[model samples]
Target: MRLAFSLFVAGFVTLAAPVAAQSPDPVAPVKEVMDVTVTNWSDSVDEWKGIFEGDRLNRLYTKELVELYKKASEKAAKIFESEEPVDPFDYDVVTNSQDGCPLQDVKIALAGEKDGVSDVAVSFRLWACEDNADTKNLVSEVHFDVVQEDGKAVIRDIHHVADGERDSVIEELKAIIAQEE
Candidate 1:
């Protein structure tokens, strides 16, 4: 009887391991997006232009946000081809800045969750490359609204606060798409 009980316990433990490992992490999707952004920080401007477009966009963002980005990109392309070209997306959406140093000390945490959605807070410091005495250690925080879709987490929206201004990436994309129409 003792031998049979031991065997049953061992089998249960072995079977439970895979289930625990397969559990979804709420912070994973946000971290994936941030990892790619920081890794390609020093890439050329032309290369960075597609960072939030194409396959990456579809994979990282929610369906609604992806559609908005597509529309915004289309409008920006039209403006670029006109006789007087102007870049609609003048700033980097991810960092919320036109210029910045390489990101460091990146931290991601789950701020809250409600109704099956999670808010992931990401904070990072920009390491200043120059030896300027006046340049402060710049720190920024961006919050991602994440939701599960088809068993995987996707970013539904992004919230940014910079220079005393608050904005949503979704609304900004919509504004860009409506600019010339």
Candidate 2:
């Protein structure tokens, strides 16, 4: 009876050992690398305009960010508001161009969000963001890459390549960014 019991115990140990080894811990890959992507803002200017025109800037920006955008937009519009009647939603009028820049895709990615700061990556479509001969030193588009600070999104830098038609807009934005004292 003792010899039979020993044999059974050994067999059970071998089977259970193999089963435990086959199971994988689900949390093994918990430490993952994340990448935040920042993309050019002007590439998809028209597309973004469409989204915001149908919706509200508040849906897309924080309250502070929206306020800044509003101030800049209003300032620029005031500068050229007399150029023609603009509906604000009408890019044809906003740009005052019979034909405007083609659609270019701009995207931002969040690699990781931790503590108070977020890691991001950004880029834009240079081909579509370029200036035309008619702009005459105006900024057709401005792309901003920012790190949010103190409950506000602060632009780390700006990328501008436009003609005269867009200069007022660029200057207005620079003023707004600078005013975040």
- Candidate 1, number of clashes: 0
Please provide, for model 2 over 1-181, each residue's C-alpha lDDT reduced to its tens digit, 9 standing for 90 to 100: 9999999999988877755433222111111100111111333343333322333444333345446555655555565555432233233212324443442444345445455434343333333535564342333443333444444444332333355232333344447445432
Identify the runs in model 2 with alpha carbons over 4 angstroms from their true place. 1-52, 83-108, 128-181
TM-score of candidate 2 on Cα atoms, chains taken together: 0.33
Report lDDT (Cα) of residue 51, candidate 1: 48
TM-score, candidate number 1: 0.78
Error of model 2, residue 116, in angstroms: 2.2
User: In candidate 2, how many clashes are counted?
Assistant: 25
| Per-candidate local distance difference test | 0.76, 0.38
Cα lDDT over the full model 1: 0.76
The C-alpha TM-scores of every prediction are: 0.78, 0.33
Provide the RMSD of all predictions against the true structure, rounded to 1 decimal. 4.1, 13.6
